[model samples]
Target: MPSLPTIVLVDDAAEVRSLVRLQLRLAGLGEVVGEGADGRDAVVLAAQWSPDVMLLDVSMPDLDGLGALPQVLEASPRTRVVMYSGFTDPALAEEAVRRGAVSFVQKSTDLDALVGEVRRLLPGEQPAAAPDAVPGAEDHDPRAAARELEQHVERFAGVFDDAAIGMATLTLQGRLVRANSALARVLGRESADVVGNHYPEVVRSGGDADGRLTAALERATRGDDDVVEVEHRYRGSHLRTTFSPVRDQRGRPLYVFAQCQDVTRQRQAEDQLRQAERRFRLLVEAVEDYAIFMLDPTGHIASWNSGAQRSKGWTAEEIVGQHFRVFYPVEVARSGHPEHELMLALRDGSYHEEGWRVRRDGSRFWAHVTITAVHDEEGHHIGFAKVTRDNSERHRLLEEQERYARALAEANERLERANHQLAAAAEDQAQFLAVTAHELRTPVSVLSMSGRTLGEHWRELDESERDEILEGMETSSARLQRLLGDLLTTSRIQASTLDLRLEDVELAAALAPTVDELRRVHVGAELRLEVEAGTRVRADPGRLAQVIENLVANAVKHGAPPITIRALAVEHSVEIEVRDAGEGVPVELLPRLFERFTSRGAGGTGLGLHIVRELSRAQGGDAWYDPVRTAFVVRLPASGPP
Candidate 1:
């Protein structure tokens, strides 16, 4: 029985060491003699176990596998070291090669390679780079060198087939001599099917232009270093080909090499980016309200659009390098607000506001402005994007509306005053109607009675008796004429043009005539006309006479006759009351009864009492109905005796 070669496994994890040990033993190459969890322990264990091969993990605590490789070799001089780790660090692998490591294998399921490397490194076999291992040297086996080269070719063939990029080789005549599985897949054909065909003919079958392929081949044949990107349609699908010239060391063309990759998705993205840029340009130019442009970091204008010329009166050629502060007034520029606003946008990415801006012609405008910082994909600040709108028209429209509103308010105030005066005039006309009705009805009643009586006694009377009766009728006729004159005076007050003929008149003297007139008209009721003898009021005598007559007449019509007319004179004014025995006014209606059309009497036109109220006021006094006493009071400014 031959003694089985000893194996030492090293890893930082127990599970990895256990699995590796199980796999190695299952392969029947060797039995695990010892195990270690770190590089240092692996080195110690190698010396202790004296294993034929030491499988060491490249990464460990305290000492990494590469650091412990020398220690493992020195401690166990006869033992072989094979680096086993998950990381494929080329630097670590090269270092192991320099440091006399037997071989390097990845920590994966390629356990056969592990056993093979171990078997090749066992004692009595020369190293890969032994001094006499080269062909044509002493003790060199030509058969062994040829066998090694064949194995290298087989391994490289598998690698070429599995490469990520498509690889192909063409002969000097542009024949597709050799092509990997990946290359065939890119061109949508089988590797064996295109082997004897010309490269251009195969590409033409796949929808690539024959002329483009031929031109590239010609360049490659001349050894001028041809390289190009070609697109081909294969199996109704698109493919991208990257072609490079393969040249010999003597500067002669050998074969053309081509690598193909799927650039369809990348090309689509670039097309989409171009379309998006086109749409953005259209949208920016279509904006009619904003003067959008770009500004360099120093606030110099960079580009201009149609809106810029329309809004700011500056064309692109004239303003491209001009400072943007030209759009600001002198005070605004002096305040450094424009520069500060741009700096803020540069710092924070966006700044927006509305303010007054100056145009190229020095005219000012209200502007809505925004400054946004443009940045690169890596977040480096580039410059500011500015957009401005001319809002001066809207501002002027608002000012016009405000001016119209102020004018409307003033007109409304004047109209309100005119309405109030018209209301007063209407009320005076109403009062005059009531007063005229009472004043004229008395004389009309007497003339009616006197003419009837004279007609009845004409046959019995003598000439003297008829003449005296006619003279009495004539006196009453004259009295009726005087009453009509007073009615005319109150109508002038309604037209808003009542003229006062001022005169010194005694209050008592004005009352006597009105009292006598009332007695004749309202004989069915008691009438009391009392005057404070020395009472006088300053006013138009004719107007005062009209005032006294109106008060007495109102007492007769609205009050029970035997209506008392009492006058009391004070320092500044005189008060006359027409006491009525009629039903007192309602509490709610008392205030409006003096207003025009406020009377509830059927025969009353509502203007009679309203006219008397206005007439009293026009004389610089006021008239009011006292609800408490059921009487109408007329206050008049005092006049001294004539």
Candidate 2:
């Protein structure tokens, strides 16, 4: 009669809103004047109608109920907003109440209770007094009241029959009084068949099911608690069962309301997780190439794998409680390197290094080690995981390669030296060709000139003139012959075929003819002979003579006047000295004095001194220069010992 207490319904599901509206009408509690499918529409409808009560769903597409709550209240100041949701979260209900919601209701609440709550909150509504205390309460029509009670019971029955969750009611004697279709389906039976059956006999126990059902039911019946829950298997299906006691008005337990949920998927997921952990343990234990282990925060060894036992030479029993620093060399351990590595790993999440590590026998091996910080789900550092690989073989190979590289470098240096020597020899050969041509041309020019002069002026010249011309030709011929002989001797020496006819001879006598000839040829230079008579030497006469000739000729070409030839006897040798009066060779050129192609000035060929040394040596003597005395001295083996 109070304008039917108009209401506005808001829900995302049209069916849910329709159900609530039907329940309200059937219970004779209120009239739903308007409806909206979402919170935004709900706000608009509440403003337009200014309904007495607004039943708003919490979760809706676009502009949820909480977000629209204040706006709706602002628009319709007198509207009482009730937040309702399928979620049974008490915190959400409390929050909604705090945010100006007059009340909160779960979508799963019995239709009678929901209707009663709406009716209680209706405008101008007063709480009903007890039937005995109310004036004229007994005068009400029995038929109408009976019909209203019947509709309430029918609505409750409708909800219970249509519920998606498995639900049933059990009497205090443990007999099923009523069962929903969902619960009957879970038990693979008809609702009528389940209603009369004993609960414990219908639901069988599973693995380790030691009277859990009887215990949970007994606890609920004894008033110890309103609800008792247990997870067990029934008919090969995992189920989570909750027993809630439904008490009478006097607080005596009347029935147990049971809820059963199929949790097979959840149980399967848990089983898979346990199996994965077991497989990981087996894998870690089987690995043997790398030392895999864990270290606690204080650097003590915590876990060790089979790989760790083989690689680090420590069994789990030996190393598990020990400090990780024992695996490091003494020097490394003393330097706090192990702790430093752990600190780095903790700070940066991981650290890696390749260095020396000690084994159980105190032998050292190069190892590549990795340390990774291990943390719990809350991100608190607990310890470190370490992986170590022996790299000693790689290190040895690297060292061997370095040694091979050094040896190759030394060989390259030797090859470079040989190449330099070859280049020098090529240069000397080129110089010899040029100098020999010049030396040969000088003698040929003299012969050509003397022959032409003799042929043209033979009759016109006097005897002395002819004799002088003939003598000049003879000298040129002899010079040509001597040059040819030097070339031949050099060839023979190179071939290692220069044979010496050894003989004993007086050294002074052997040098006398060479000196006289040199004196006759160089009329301007004076010759002095300092001879020690009876200075005998073992010598080849021709080769020794050639040595004296080349030395004297060198002195004649390079020295000033007063060339002195001295012969002396020394221990085990005869010393022949050709001295000149000139400053000696430059100190820088002294080392290469007897080398081929070494000449002070251009007139004489550079081969002279080189040939002199070779020929002197062939005759069992050696030729060398005296820098201090400006002398070329020859030492021949003495013919007779002193």
Best by lDDT: 2
Give the residue spans of candidate 2 off by over 4 A.
1-363, 366-414, 449-453, 456-475, 583-588
- Collision count of model 1: 19
Kindly list the per-residue Cα lDDT of model 1 for residues 1-642, writing each as its tens digit: 878888898876554564456445434567788888677898889789888889887645445576678889889988888986533334445556666687778653234456568768665443322122223334544334434534543464465567666766554556554567787777777776766456778877766654665676666655454355556655555666645444321234434555566666656777997999899867856787679999988899999988899899998999999989999999989999989999889878899888999888989998978899998899877788998878776668546756997997999799879969964543343234223333343234334433433343345446865576566557557655655454454457657888876555687777687667767765665777788788877666666556556655556555565578788876689888878677766687676777543444422333456667777788888888877767878888886655
Cα lDDT listed for each candidate = 0.66, 0.72
Assess candidate 1 and give its TM-score to the true structure.
0.31
Off by over 4 Å in 1: 1-490
Give candidate 2's whole-model lDDT. 0.72
Residue 119, candidate 1: how far off, in angstroms? 99
Tens digit of lDDT per residue, candidate 2, span 404-445? 879978997998799699645534443353345334433443
